[model samples]
Target: MNIQEYIESGILEQYALGELDDAQRAQVERMATEHPEVQAELEDVQRALNAYGEAHALTPPPGMKERVLANWQAAIQSEPGQAPAAPATEPVVRQLTPPRSEPAAAEIAPSRVSWSMAAAVALLLLSAAANLVFYNKWKQAENDLAVAQNQQASLASTMQAVNKNLTYRNQELAVLRSEQFKTVALLGTPAAPDARARVLYNPTTKAVYLDVRKLPAPPSGKQYQLWALDQGKPVDAGTLAAATVAGDSLQQMKDIASAQAFAMTVENEGGSPTPTLSTMTVLGKM
Candidate 1:
């Protein structure tokens, strides 16, 4: 075989581009090992290809890769006899030589390498696009679920508060409407001239309920206490909560078997064992 003619046949270019079958590639490698000229020519072909790729590098327009990949895939899937005609586009690389009328059947064609590489790139881009779409949909679903859970929690808390308020109001209404309860008037004393309150007593059940009409706010570390005076001696009733002092609603007190009068006094927090006479705010007889 003429070595110079073989070098000029563009066979080295096909070898560099990996367009040769395994048996043909081994034959080329054997030639390069035996002749320093073939080895040097192979290296030159590889360098030229690298330089050409760099010089022709282009930043494609946005979304162009996807469009080209779609078209390429559709063409590949078409039946062999009914393949779509290629669209007019710029040539990727110039042909090394004009086609001959008759060529050796064993020689690899350049078109095979071009089509193989295009198919590989198209499939890769399509896979990447599919993954991105699925990931975005998953994240959106997670965000929607979080928002729904937060709204449900807020609604549950509001309903609980409303139910508790309704129960308190119902109890207050029942006490006011009962016919068995006797109402008592507690007049304000000189210390709190504007302070006034009332007491409801059920004689049969011995239930006592205190209702403040208007009262002065207790000092810090102090609370209002109710006393039942049975025959002039003060009996401990119960201490008032902050809501009761504000006259928000009626408050149930410790039951009293018998009492001639009811009075209110300011005492230390949680109330004292005995009433403090100087702190008396109101007094009323039943």
Candidate 2:
């Protein structure tokens, strides 16, 4: 248990006010016995209560002594058989009609004003404490809301990315299954004996897609580019995206209107207008 949090929870104040049930009082006592800080705080709360009462204690009105003396004399003079005006023994009746005192009134005015001001200050303190507690709760609620909104946004972003990946895979699956597309397997060149890839072509639509089976990681600042051979002349197809080069997925390259052969060669970050024949990695005849 957090001792400071427990102390500030106002349970000690309730205990000081004698508002706790027997079970609650026992619990507080047990805690106080176990924790010296709790015991000290409980003592301070009790002392503050006692001080407030003593500060606000009522003083006897002036001439109280004279009134009591007068009542005592009257009670003694009453006929013995009458029980000495039975109610005369009560001091409350005499106290209600205290004789007006100019000096006493003068002294009481400042005390009354001081007591009223003290009461106002006490009320202000209580109000301030209540506001402080409410403000802390409001701040905690705001923090919790912000955290929840961020988590919800993160979850939404993750779901969108997953859905996009699923859509791309579905399209790739359709292209692989369709009979309209012709598959061309490109065998590795002498430069790279193990490199292999396949190209899918739809002659009617002139569409082209590349699916890499294996490819070496490119050198820094270099990328793989595809070319279409038509009548012994090379036409630039397009460069591969990193995902395609990594064999992560099928990549749709630039459209090819006509071609007798297809090949890949290493180029700069962007493809060159003409292929570097010496850097050719794979070639295939359709």
Candidate 3:
């Protein structure tokens, strides 16, 4: 098969994941040996996957190695024709002896010790590498878990904010339906013909519910300002940020009294001292 077809067959991914059957694995190994490009690509995929696995590895439970070694020794002892098992508390060491007659005294001791030390150092290095790899994998998994937890917390916070807003709006709607309350619909102005708002005023409780759902998002460094107006002169009710624009409803001001009408205008953040007539979006009479 061509390289593209070979890659598209999904065998490479399986090989990287160590899921291939023995026959398929042998074939891939043979091919990798024969083709340098194939070998390079295989190595790249394997390295990437290994890195990912390492990044998400979990620590093995303690005492596992001891358990594994104990089982192995038990199995070895149970084998037919095997030597008798050694005592559990006794230390066992295997010694290698060279033929003594022709060997020089100086060469024998140093060479043997040197070879043994070299073997020990090599084993130590391999063990260290393995331990480092395992540690890195465990740390990576912990970091990933922490990040996932943080994301879940952020989503929960957002949901709580939404729920709180919904509860507040429902309470306002309930008050508006009461006998002592007055409802007023605000029509869109010439500056923004598609926009509209509503005001539910409770005279008994002196609360005003202003819904500015239809208003557009204000420009950067600007905000939507609500005005409680009497005879064209305006009183600052509240200022709304861009986040309030796309939501279903907004509770801009509460506990308002002695206002004849309500109006909205686009103005600087924290609102202007008075409504900017030219930028007015909605107007309503109570």
Candidate 4:
């Protein structure tokens, strides 16, 4: 099988868990030794499982050592050469007794056994609980990683769509540029001598390219309004945003008739019903 297919076959997980039989384990180990990538994947899986196990080890029972010692002592006593007396049902409580004090050892043996058994059961339960918690945490992390990967794929798709749209728009702009387009340079006026703009008007197609690259940004509550002037009176064209100053061109509406000049003024956000003639920034004649 291919490396990717082998990795996906669940054998790696089984190997990590040590669930494979002897022959299968040897085969996996041999493959891992031969393939660095497989080795790395195996190491990662093993490390994760090892960490989970360490975080969930069972604690030995309380007084287990004493109980085992008591049982060993009894076994030794039962032997022919040994002389130590067999401990009683309840071994002496040495924890509360002075070492020098002579007490019946069997008095506390049963209590020790009981305590040891209880502690052993408790430790087993705690180990099980810890294992379950670690398993859940691992599952949750895996789920989160899957979700993030899915989101990344979605974002990549969206970017591809946006790039396609931009390419189409650029093609359309090239077509427009090829037609009967007239370029009009709008000079900065006295009120704002630093601001300038250009209008690329295609009379045949009735399309306008308003390039406002040299224009200053409008105030927060206002935008720049374009007008098509006939004689001395100006006709409303369309509004442009502050983004127009950042080298991004704006496409205005089409079909302007008998326009002798173009002018721009700062007006309210939606633009004024009439041009704010006093705040005019740039003006240009056709």
Per-candidate TM vs. native? 0.57, 0.61, 0.45, 0.49
Worst 10 residues of 3 by lDDT: 93-102
Candidate 1: stretches off by over 4 Å: 1-130
Query: Residue 78 in model 1: shift from native, Å?
Result: 37
**After TM-score superposition, what is the CA distance of residue 232 in candidate 1 from its true location, in Å?**
1.1
**Per-residue lDDT of model 4, residues 1-286, tens digit only:** 9987888898999988879999999999999999998999999999999999999998779999778767865775478355345566225533554333323565578878988999999999999999999999999999999999999999999999999879867854874566577877899999889887888777777677677758777778888888988888888878885555665655654467657789998899887889988999999998
In candidate 2, which residue ranges exceed 4 Å CA deviation? 1-119
List model 3 lDDT by residue over 187-249, tens digit each.
Answer: 889888888878777777777767665877778888888888867678887876465566556
Worst 10 residues of 1 by lDDT: 89-98
**Better lDDT candidate (2, 4):** 2
Tens digits of lDDT, candidate 2, 25-118: 9999999999999999999999999999899988779999778767865775574465445576656634653434434675898999999999
For residue 158, give model 1's deviation from the true position in Å: 2.5
RMSD of each: 18.4, 29.1, 36.0, 32.6
Worst 10 residues of 4 by lDDT: 93-102
Q: Rank the candidates by TM-score, best first.
A: 2, 1, 4, 3
Query: Which candidate achieves the best TM-score against the true structure?
Result: 2
**CA lDDT, candidate 4, residue 155:** 99
Clash pairs of candidate 4? Answer: 88-106, 90-106, 90-107, 90-108, 90-109, 91-106, 91-107, 91-108, 91-109, 92-108
